[model samples]
Structure formats: structure tokens, C-alpha cells
Target chain A: MPQQRVVRTIIIADQQGLHLRQAVECAQAAGRYQSQIILVSGERRAENCRSPFEILQLGAGYGAAVTIEATGPDAEQAVEEIAAILSRQTSH
Target chain B: MEIKRGVAVSPGVAIGPAWVLDTEEVRIGERFIATGTYPEEIERFDRAVQAAANEARQIQKTVSERLGEQYGAIFGAHAALIEDPNLRQEVAAQIRDHSFTAEYALSRVIRRRAKILAGLNDRILADRQSDLFDIEKRLLRQLVGQRQAQLQKLSEAAILLAHDLAPSETAQLDRQHVLAFATEAGGRTSHTAIVANALGIPAVVGLGPFLTDVSGGDLVIVDGNRGLLILDPDAETLERYRQAQAAQAGHERELIELRDLPAITRDGVRILLLGNIEFPEEAAQILERGADGVGLYRTEFLYLGRKEDPTEQEHFQAYLKVLRQLPGKPIVIRTLDIGADKFRSAVEPPAQERNPFLGVRSLRLCLHNKSLFRVQLRAILRASAFGDVRIMFPMVSTLAELREAKLLLHDVMDELNEEQVPFNPQIPVGTMIEVPSAALIADLLAKEVNFFSIGTNDLIQYVLAADRTNENVAYLYNASDPAVLRLIEQVVRAAERHGIPVNVCGEMGAEPMYAFVLIGLGLRQLSTPPSAIPELKRLIRSITVEEARRAAQAALQMESAQDITNYLRDQIRRILPEALAV
Candidate 1:
């Protein structure tokens, strides 16, 4: 089968934006699947989604739209997970 | 004195010279280097980053355990940032192409990253600028060969003034030299605040850049009782504080005078006041404060500040030190209570714990690692030969854990016997009634142990399913909660039925309001930090058993913790207002 890819743009809803906890949750969740997960904020793209440092370095703050892209067997699931984390109102 | 206000985390009065601990700023100016030095510079940068990452990991473990997992994750991000391939590549490329010094290149990259985040035009992204700053500071500190300021090496006893203290740094503070601490940043529930309270020092945090206003070695008074920091007092202010200090000293003198006397209530009921100590050096303070014995000698300190587990000899020597200090006084040596808020890298690798409070720690960790348990047991047994030592297993949730621990103790005793080494064969064995299950089954557990010491700190948390460290659920972590009281009552009643002496060794016993409730619950023995002994003894002496029992009963009947707290506070206020500073 040809490699599947899924991409979705989600606005960061967390009031504190993509801080350590949210970034950690995203990275930790991304680690669950065998997919190449990448987050794009305007021109800056973070391919190392497993590292909270890289995701947070993107500096996608509150209400900032960031694109989540995943390519692999679990591409769709990875996109869903990243989007879910972005849409979550509270990090705690 | 020029006074400033902040949140009072720990209560006391401390007047001393201010030892200002300012964070060192590393200004990395651009320096062009030779072409041949690029590899060496890059290598140097890598080593610094590696060292920084290791430091961050260690800090992360401590912060995670002390604060919460989420708070700990900040350090995780820091470590990641330090080891970020993108960051490393940028600095390496800058050094290779621009011929810049490693520090210069790294600084430039970090500044650009921080600037990007700051310019994000969103609150969340903007706040991350601080995180970048933290990473830069850590890396630079590593590169500059500058160690984190050592609070352990003060020449004289002084009130510490710092911008903010990391939990690890706070843990390193020598209570002898650092009389008190006033931080320019930190909330009431900050790590510094918790550690200050644990160290029994007066502390004021959130003073907002008070460091800039005061010079090092200047006279400063930290009135933690009122959350005030006074700088360079006038004669009248100095006189006032001196008098207050003298009066406080005089009060302590009075309490010390009663040291030789028994802690007897007005009704002629004698109460046993023991000291909860973590180190052998605290024996002097405990004895000076008039404690009957060491109730809880938290042996976890042996496992901290080292890369390797303490040897059998090391453990014995440490126990012997404390044992020798107190010849006649019963020293209840709790065997390695490592878990929850307390962790040792030397004992085991860090596990990703969802809820460490409920995880395998304390006696559970001991049972799992029998050899480690046996070594401590052997040490405790050997130390018992020199002094009145009792071996207590902490965090015993079930009879099985209690049995497993005892069985290991027996094995150690057998091993000692085989080696023909002398040990106290009849050293009293006990288990802490901290876990709610253990509290619920206290009657059953009473059959196995020689005595009971209620660790109310964990008992309250376990009973309420609330993490005491967490600020969000802090309200539910109250010891005055009727549910928590009921559990304490249960443990007390169980001990009573079994004819075993029950003592409270948690912070609850130290607090006046909760102390009243604990006394009323029939806990005649109370162990607390040595600093609290004087005030607590005075409180105990003022109130009769009947009054305490009545107050406890009233507290038990109250539905809400707030109501119970109010009822007890009112009772305490009506009875012995002087015992309580607030």
C-alpha cells in the first residue's frame, strides 16, 4: 500500500497555549503510534513531535492555528490525537 | 527597618545579616575564533549541553516528586531543549561557518529562539520566552564552570535572600547556617515554601525583586509570622525586634526549663513528646527542645545526595551516630521510607509514575528489594545494640507487607547471628499507620507490631485521595477533614485495644489545632520537628484532656474540614491563644 498521509489545522485552545504540559501530552501521545508526526506553525515546522522541546519551540500560542501532519500506518490516528490535544480546553 | 510584604509560608521570627544569593548572569559576547578550533568548540558545547541535560534530569526527578508530574515536565522540556538536535546543529553551524566562540554561538541561538517565542504575539507563546531563558542559563552555567550557589557553605548563620530557589537547591540548605530565607519570587505553595516549612525556618516569598534593594551582609529581619522582610532597621525598630527576639528566646528558655520536666497536662495527664528527625545531627536540637525520644528517624536521607546506595557499613555508621547521640532515648529508625515525595536515584531508576503517592514505595519497595531491606535491617539491629533503637516499617498498607518486612528483619537477624555479630534481639518492631487500608485494619495490624506511630501527613492524603503537594486539590488535603479524623480515631482506638502505645509523628501533631484533635483522639505520644516542640509543649500543658477530647469529638462530628478547622481554631483561641502565632 502507498504511504498514507493526514494533515489537519487546529487552533491551540489551551489558555496557557502549547506550554510544557500540553507539549508533553502531544509528544507522549504522538509516541503511541508508528507515524512520522510533524507540527507546522506558519513557516516553522517541528518534525520531532516526540520531543516536547521541539513542539514548544514552535511557540504556537493560544488561538494560534498549527497544522498537524502525519505519514505512516497510523497517520490518521496521530492526526486525531494531536488535534484532540490542541482542542482540549484544559491541560491539567 | 524598611519593611516589605510577601506570602508567609513558614512561621517564626528571624533577625540576621542578609546573605543575598543573586543568579549569575552570563553575557556571551561574540568572539571570532580560528578555523582549526571549530571541532573543539563544537565538542566543548556538546559536553556542556550533555552536562546540562544530566543536571536538568536530576532536577526534573526532584521537581516531579515534590511538585507534580506536570511541574516536573518543565525540566523535561529543558533537558530536551538542551539536547535538541536543531539547537545543537545551529550552534555547531555558527561555530563552523561564522568562526564564533561556542558560548557566543549558543547564546545567539538561544536569544533568537527566545525572541521568536516572545514575538509570537500570544500570551502562551510569549510566556515560553522564560523557558528559553532557563535553558540558556542552565547551559551557560555548565559552560562557565559555575556551580549553583551552595547554601550548604555559609560562613555564618544568615537570613538567605534569593531571587528563587530550585527544590534541589532548597534541599541542600544547611539549617544551621541559613537561619531563615526570604525569596523575591515564589508563592505560598512553592517548593521553597514547602522546604522552608520542613526545615522549620521562617520564610517570606514573592517579595518581587527585593534582591536589588538589599546588599549582602546587611542587617535584615525576616518576620515570617507576618510575612514581612525588614532591611536595615533604625534604632527603635532594631530595639523593637531585639525585644521581640529576646521575648521569643525567653519563651523558648521557659520551654527549655520545662525540658527536664514531663509534658503533663493541667489535669496531671502525662504526654510523651518525641522528635521527628531526618538526620543524626538533629538529635541535639530534639534533646534541647525537650523531646522524650526520637519518634521518627526518617532514614531516607542516607539514600539522598549520593550516586550509589548506602552500604551496610555506611547505614550502620549513620544509625550508630544517631544512636550514640541519644543513649537512653528510644530512637525509632524507620527503614528506608523512599517513595511518594521522597526518591533516591541511588536506590532505583526513575519510573514514570502516574500517582506516586499510591505507587509502590516505602515498605512496598523494601519488600520488592529484600536485599536492600535486609542491609538496613541489619544496620538498625546492629545500631540497636548501642542505644534504645526500635525498627519501624513505613507505608505498610496491609498485614502482608508488615509480615514480609518482619520476615526480612528476621533473615537479617539470622545472618547477623551466623556472623556472630551482636545485635539487639528484642528491638521493638512497629509499622506506620499511614495508608488508609492500614488505618482501616489498624486493629489487625496492631497484633503484629510493638507500637503504632501515625504518620498523619500520608494518612490524611491517603484517606482523602488527595495529593498534599498539589495546589489545585490542596483544600482537600486538610488533616482536619472529618474523614481523616475518623481514620486517626480508628488507629488510636485500635492501638488502645491492643494495649500498644500510639504516637502521631506527622505535621498534624506539630500544628496546634490538629494537635488538640490528635490529643483528643487518645494519642498520648506526639512527635514533631524539634522547632515545634516548645510551642506544642506549652499548648499541651495549657489544655486539659477533657477539653481536648471535647474539641476532638466536636471535630469528628463536623461534616466539612472547614467547619472542623473553625471549631478547633475557636477552641484553641479560647484556650491557649499564645501557643498559636496566627
Candidate 2:
């Protein structure tokens, strides 16, 4: 069996963008996966998906594109979950 | 003796040992560790991180259960950040590679990361740096074994000296042991100041850069009335404060003796002396002080220092508490009167406004956020069924704003009816005559509302165009300014014309000189802090309404605020010499 890597780019759909609470949601979603995940925005990249601090440092604003990259056995699942969090619009 | 001056938020005099709180600026002096102790340093760091993470989780659980999951999630995010594997890796690397102590290594890594977040273009994202700094503080406390001063567990009475106090910290303060407090930072309306006033604790705040000059257990004086913090006072200064404290005690006893008496002028004109309170608990104090009823029950405290907007139930519960405490008494529940900057946690982040006071606040904020307004209106309506609960809209500058607020109140009433919830449909609704425009058009506005509460604090600032908190222009913010006096007079006259009851509910109503002016201006009702009620009663009994009117007329004709102030002082001195002492 070979190691697999998955990458997906998603636009921030929440009106407040990737704020602290949204970043928490992203980190919590990434924490459930076994694969290592990273979020990339512009020139900056957050290597640790489980750290909300790093994810927030990505400074992804509303409608800004963010790239999620994952590797390991559950790389595809990790990418899907993280992308859903980034693309989902939260009313509150 | 060293003296520092700041804004006096609460009134009194206290002499006690200082309990200086350890601020967030924890200096890590020992930067390097022995080469052989790298493993031990890493273990120490790991233990601190574990403890900090556990504390964050505990707070999250408690806060989530109390406030809501939204607020709890804030602490949850902090816990995740505390246990961040990337952060741990960097700290361990610093210790292993550079022989750095855990405290120094952690601070360096956290500061570097926080700086990055702070430098980001996104304002909201940049604000997260505060969370990072908070985490750093928690970690440092654990690593250094320097626990935060347990304000709740103090054994001896002391005056607290701190750089700043979060609302949560101030909420947990054990009032019995805290005789008074002086802070290096805060304004008149800060949570600490409000709590101090509520607790009747002497407090002076916004004394910049004094915490570094003082130490724990050093004798200090918190002269809240004078807004002065004196350190290691000389014998003469100490004797003076001691005598002043004694005089105040005697004066308070004298006032308390008059608590059962009515605030009727010598000419037989009865005046309504109501108490203005921030919390529901203060209702009892108002009754004890012999107030007629609550003139202004500020509802902003419930919304402050919390992560989420208070639920409809929370609002109802708070109003019900006050109503139950003051049964059959008029409780004027002023609808959410906070500026956006004050309650950032409750309100969604609006674009940063340069002038927040003049920006969307109070009734304007309520109108824009209808759900927030609806929830409060529903609560007030529901509470009205229990007792006399009057709803008053704050910062109603225009007739349309007042009408719109009334329309929403009606909407809430309709909803309550549809839901089959019991409430008083005809509950009295009023508007605060705070803005200058509202004061000018009081005649028109009086016809719309059941009553009018003159909020002099905002009215003075708005008319004078001075921010009282800004020291440079604070002198311009005067209640005795002829312009302010004339506007107050106009409002009273307009209210009289419409046969609507009007009262002064700001700080002006609490002061002897200003209260005299207000009485003379034809204000029959005055709402002040409960502690001030007894003294006001004494003043009311001393002078005739006729005399007050004459004094006020003289004041209105004066050219300068200083002249009017001096004239009123002289008049008050002649009538009641003791009132001038306050």
C-alpha cells in the first residue's frame, strides 16, 4: 500500500471569515481525522490543523480562497471534512 | 508619601494594606538552563501546558453550561491552542537546542507567534493575539508556580492595586476582604468601576503606571471621593484621612436617621426621590434608603462580561428579580444602553467606528438588531405582569426612533399574545431624554411616551460636545453649563405641558448642587444611587421649592458654568452646610 496525499481549495463562506470560533470549528474537525492536514492562504500556510492559533494566523477573510492539504491513510477524508468547515456559511 | 490621581468611580475613603495583583507582564529573568537539564526543562514545560489546558477545559465546561456553548467554545479553542503540538515542539526545540529555561522558551515562542497574528491585515484575526497572550499568561503562572492572587480567599482587609481587572475577576471579588481598590487602567463605566459602585466599595481607577511603584502589604490610601491613591502616607495626611473618614461615618449616620422621612420641601411640595440601580440586587438598597421607587434600572450589566447575548429567559429572570424585590414599586427598566465597544462579546463585531459614542449604540443598536431588541422587549413585557415594570428606550435622538421602538414593543406584545404567554399589554413605555435633539423636541416626544427620564450624563456631553473621559475636555463637560440647564428646563416645561411625569436619572440628580438646580428647573422627581437617597432627602427637607426656583433662575441667567456652580454652592452652603462637604 502507498501513502496518499489529498489537496483541495475552498472559499471562506462565513460572513465573518475564518474568525476564532470558525477556526476552532476547523481545528476540531481536523482533530477527528488520522491524517496530518495543513491550510494555505496566500503566502502563509498553517502546518498544524489541530492548532486554531495557526489556522487563524492564515488570516483567511470572507470569500478568500484557502487550500487544504492532507496526507496519510485518511487524507481524502481529512480534506473533505476541513473543506466542508471552510466552505460552510454560519449564521451566528 | 507618593500620590497618584485617577478617575473616582465609586465614593468613600479607605486606608488599608495594598494587595498588588501580578499583571500579565510576567518577566522571565532566567533565560538559560544548564546543558544537562534540557530533559527536566522540557518536562516542566509539558506539565505547565497540561495544567493550563486542563484549566481552560474546566472554564469552558462551566462557562458553556452557564452562558451557552458559544461562549464555552472560546475556552475550548484556548485549550486546543494550549495543547498545540506545533507549539510544544517549538518550545521543546528551544530548550534542547539553546539551553533555554521553560519559562523563557515558552515566552519567546508565544510572543513570536502572537506578533505574527497581530501583524495580520484582518482585524478580527489580529484580535486573536489577545487569546494567545492570555494562554501565555496561564502557562507562565503554572511554570513559575506563581498563582494569581486569590481575591476570593483573602484573609485580611486590603486595598487592591492592579494594572487591570477583567470583569470576571471583578465579579468574583470577595467584598468583605476588599476594603477598596485602585487600578492602573479603567474609565468611569468600566465593569470594575460599576461593580465597585454596586458594592459601595471605594475605588479609584485609571491611575496609570503606579502598580510598579508599589508592592504588596505596603500601606496605601484609596480616597475615592477625591480620586487619589496615596502610598505610604505621612502622619499628617493619615490623620486628615482618618478624621475625614470619621466625619463621613457620622454624616452617613445622620443621613440614615432621615431615611424614614419624605423628601418634601419646607413649602409642602412633595418630591419623588427614586434610586438608580445597575443590578436587581440593588433594589433592596433602594427601598432601605427610603426611595419611592427605582427611577432607572440599568439593564446593560446583564449583557456585559459575557460571551453570548443573554437569552430571553435570562432577561426575564433579571427583571423578575428586581420586580419581586421591589413589589408594586415603579422599576424603570432602561433597555440595553451600551455602546458597541463596551459589549464586544455580546454584539457581533461591527466595523470599528472612530466615534463609538455617536455611532450605533443604545436604541439605535437595538433598532438595527431587532432580534436582540425583541428578546429584551418580550422579557420586559413578561416581567410587567409580575409588578410595575416600565420600559424606557435609551439614546432616542429622534421621534422616529422612539416610534420605531414603541412599534417593536407592540410587536413583541403581539408575539407574546400569540404564544399565549401572560404579560401586561398596556405596560408603560418611555424614552430617555439623553440626546440634545430629544431634549429639544421633548414637547412632541412627551405625547408619545408615558413618561420621560432625563439622562443628564449623556445630555451634558452631547450638548457640550465633550467626552468626559478625555481629560483634555472633561472640564467642558459640566451639568451647570447654562446651555445644559436651559435644555433641562425646556424638557421639564415640555413634559409639564403634555402632563407627562418627568425625572432626572443621571449623576446630576445625585449631586446636591445639581439636584437643587434640577428641582428649581421644575423637576419633581430625581433618581439617584440608593446610597445617595438619604442625603438627598435631608437636602429636600432643608430648603423650600420656592428658594430652589429662585436659585435656579439666578443660575440660568449666569454666563459661565463656573459662575453658576459657585452661585449654587453658595446657596447650598447657606441652606445645608453639610451638603457642601460631599
Best by lDDT: 2
Per-residue C-alpha lDDT of model 2 across residues B179-268, encoded as one tens digit per residue: 998888777744456657756789998899998788899999999998999999999999999999999899888888898888899999
**RMSD versus native structure for model 1:** 8.5
Error of 2 at A50 (Å): 12
**Model 1 pairs whose backbones collide:** B1-B233
Residue B79 shift from truth in candidate 2, angstroms: 8.3
Across B54-93, the per-residue lDDT of candidate 1 in tens digits comes to 9988878876665434445567766876777778888999
Q: Model 2: what is its DockQ?
A: 0.25
TM-scores for all predictions: 0.64, 0.67
> What lDDT tens digits, residue by residue, belong to model 1 across residues A1-92?
45789999987765567666567667777878899999999778888888676788787767789999999988986887677666544432
- Give the residue spans of candidate 1 off by over 4 A: A1-92, B1-92, B101-103, B109-261, B279-284, B301-311, B336-361, B368-372, B395-401, B435-444, B461-494, B546-567
